[model samples]
Target chain A: MSATPTPSPAHAPDAAPHADGTSALLHAEGLHKTYGSTPALAGADFSIRAGEVVAVMGPSGSGKSTLLHCLAGIVPPDSGRVLYRGRDLSALSDAQRSALRRGDFGFVFQFGQLVPELTCLENAALPVRLAGAGRKQAEAQARQWLERLEVDDIRHHRPGQVSGGQGQRVAVARALAARPSVVFADEPTGALDSLNGERVMQLLTEAARDSGAAVVLVTHEARVAAYSDREIVVRDGKARDMSAMAGVA
Target chain B: MSISHTLLGLLETGPRHGYDLKRAFDERFGHDRPLHYGQVYSTMSRLLKNGLVEVDGIEAGGGPERKRYAITDAGITDVEEWLATPEKPEPYLQSTLYTKLVLALLTDRDASSLLDTQRSEHLRLMRELTRRKTHGDLADQLICDHALFHLEADLRWLETAAARLDKLAKEVRR
Candidate 1:
């Protein structure tokens, strides 16, 4: 793997900050991190405007997931900065960041990670309940989201009783129930077949757009990336903006 | 789609008159443009002559007698063979976009604007498709997906072409 550094002048650390007039909801500059001998990110710069859907795509082990984690404040970069709405994320303590994540950032993972023991409605309502909403209110919000995703019939069934696609729909409903400002979905459709994957992607993007939330989606599939407003390709821990070439098709 | 094979396949369900065949075809596949009455009658007559179809019955109608056609063994075999064979993939190497690129270069026109225009058009169509997919039924969703995938490919090509415009211009000039 010949790792020639990519020149990303537009997102350089010293470049004009928020030059796009405060529309940027999330930004990362010169992010570098390493786990022992393996470097996960090497000066990767990224940013997404409000309500935009950006896809982070690369081959396996190319730091796409790491970039997502860093931007979401789940993992701290050893060097460089991450900003959410112009505030540096590195300055926040673990608890504050955790609270921020719980309240403002929604996440959808490849396997859904829904609690098998909990019913679909409960799983969807968990985040809202964690944010201190009453059980009734949380469940009501969850039910509305489930209906939006067209999986309201499975509200009473546990995750174990639902198919993989239905489980992901429930997961998506859970992710968006809080109306998070940003949604980080890491291969949300990876476990499903093509038809099911398309359905999930359509529903996810539409719901996110309707709520005016920015999305940072990580996927290696071109078909999935097509749904996003832009794509950033990570190579050898370096993020390259491919969106400029296509201008969000 | 093969018109004769489609007609035969429809007959496989049950015998139908020319008018009924046209209605069924329009309902299933020809929603955009229904088949002409003359075309349907001509196809049925040709199929009967080729022994792929046999007249099952003739019924008195308002004007002319209506002939109901049924698929024979040969027609059934033809439909099966057609279904089994894969359609040829059209690569479209010399599409209109490519022609326009070269023409712009030869005429010393601004090729970049052409690319930008095409990109916008592709994006517009994609937005339209996304709307349709969101509201469409399962079949409509599938159709929109097919078109969206192809348009995505076209957008990628347009971007790649725009990136190589300078080099292409030089090559074309030489």
Candidate 2:
């Protein structure tokens, strides 16, 4: 799972609208974080609207992953605000944040990360099962997603029994089965071949669109970023909007 | 442009009449604009002459007798070679955009505005393709991705050209 909400101090206020009168389903403002001497994020601002797919791209060690962690509340920022629907994420108790992530957020990573022993169907249903859905209800939802992703025939197979591409599809089915409000994908297709990579990206973005869930995709590949509605590039520990400079030098 | 060779490849699957060939080709690769009947027949005739294809059968029809075509062994070799060969990457050594920028500078025109206009055009197309990708199927999304990549390169070129405009203008006038 990409989401593991970190505990933070409570009683934080709701995040106000951005100075430019902009609002979004998710927002981050002046986020600053450092790890010892090396800084990860240096006053980065980001936002995403409903049903929009945003890509976070950068060179290695440029803090793209950290930005994602901050936005998802997997880690708390040194000094900033992460707001989910105007509610300050920092304001929520640890349990509340964890529950919120479980209920409304989904994640997929570069590695398929399917438990080797669990059948594909069982893996897909894990998120729902964790959320306290009945075993039958969870498996039913998982089966529907698997069929939609065209991997229903392999439902009974263990993760190792499936090919790398098929495993990623299972991961996607799992991430989307819960119908989360947002999906955070970190190089979700990095390990697959080109054909399979394209297929996975297509399914991920299309599924997000169909579910009306916003996506925050972190990837270094321009081809992958091309699928996004907007892109933010992290450079030297700062994140900036690269949508306008997409074709620039 | 490679329609003739593509038809030979298709024929390798099995013998097919011109109508069948056209439909198969359209379904696979010509979703945008299908081959015309005349083009298909003409291509078949040329392939027949070249010995890459042969008449497998003929059926009488209302307008004209339909000759089903089959690929020869030679046709299979040709297709294999074509498939193995890498396509020539279009480096665009002397691109039209480069020519336009130089011409603007040579004629003492506002090269900066030219670059700006081109940049905006590229951005416009990128935005349009982005919208299309959002709503398109897998095939449509792939097609848009291809176009978007080329346009992205053009956009990068436009920016570099804009940055060097002053230096280019000086060199051109000198």
Candidate 3:
């Protein structure tokens, strides 16, 4: 509340990004965002510890998406650095950032975001394939992740052929097939009903933590964040409160 | 990593039979990360039961065959969580030393000597850290980064602890 920051994570687990005590796997230091003078993140400082799952919640217009985008380096922060493994996003060239994003990060958006034309396994393996993995090897790893995510039953089904929740699970499995350093999601279950939403949440939470990747999800829902090892409430475009929950045993 | 953590850490190294984990852990940690043989078997049983570790299969033809422990996706998840769990720094336990504090009244040995001895050990540790870079298995940047932090923590704890003990010893002399 007094605005004194915690340590800059110079002595943390180095493996975790968030504040879950895995030691700042994803750290956004002094982040500020502006959309043509409409402020989004107001000098926000946030991090996702390694193996942590964080849910960001706020009212509409509260800049949840802005924070996610900024942290993910999808939207440039007007100020502040997004640090992954101690390297700042602002310092990387666009191409460099893209390659790191492709190799080291995974994303699940509000929509399923599945490429409709590809079958579930094909879509799930896209990132791996993009990384130049052979089609056979990529699909094989994708099948493993899909099974781990409990979506293996639909591996051959296209996005349009599956239920919305099922499609989103596929999206998550796809995002994680590369075992990225961090996984980012924007309103991951905003499209599904309660049961589906909860299922997706648990699956994402379990899958990400098991893989030791930091998962940051933006939502207005408290329950969604509860599944994470840490939760930070962003309000008025600034990180207002932060707390950590025990990691699931 | 604790005992279960030790087992999980071994799994991260790659698949191994149950006994292989025990031997590798002993080799990796030396006497410091000691384990009870029963504890290793217990951990293996639980991991298999919980679906975190799977028997990748058996290697036969050598007596009673052996089951290899590979981390299932769930096992890795468990290890990640274990790695990420909040660590309440363990209390600096040197029971014999704490005893020295309580029984220093009865000792005739010089107090400064103890301080000097401990400080040297700490300095040696810090010096070795400077000379050390993880060269082998823990070569990944992420894992190495974490190890560095832990080492730094050890160094800090040593310095602060040694300083505190020095002060305590000086006060006791007064």
Q: Write the per-residue lDDT of candidate 2 for residues A1-249, one digit (tens) a residue.
A: 223211112211223465446657788889999999899999787778767888886667889999999998899999999888777888899998998787778888899479888999999999889988999999988887887777989999999899888999999889887778788999898998867886788788877777777889998665666677777767668887654553532
Model 2 stretches with alpha carbons more than 4 Å out: A1-23, A243-249, B1-89, B92-174
In terms of DockQ, the best-performing candidate is 2
Query: Scored by CA lDDT, what does every candidate get?
Result: 0.83, 0.80, 0.70
Error of 1 at A1 (Å): 52
Listed for every candidate in order, the interface RMSD values in angstroms are: 5.2, 6.2, 19.7
Worst 10 contiguous positions by lDDT, candidate 2 chain A:
A5-14
lDDT of 3 by residue, B1-174 (tens): 467776887898799877788887777664345666777888888878899888787777552127777888888888899878998976757655556644553364654345334433433343233223222344433343345455445544433444466576666667
Q: Is the docking of candidate 3 incorrect, acceptable, medium or high quality?
A: incorrect
Best by lDDT: 1
The CA-based lDDT of model 2 is what? 0.80
Better of 1 and 2 by DockQ: 2
DockQ for candidate 3, please give it. 0.01
lDDT tens per residue, model 3, A79-113? 88888777788889999999888988889998848
- The TM-scores of all predictions, comma-separated, are 0.65, 0.64, 0.53
Sequence-dependent TM-score of model 1: 0.65
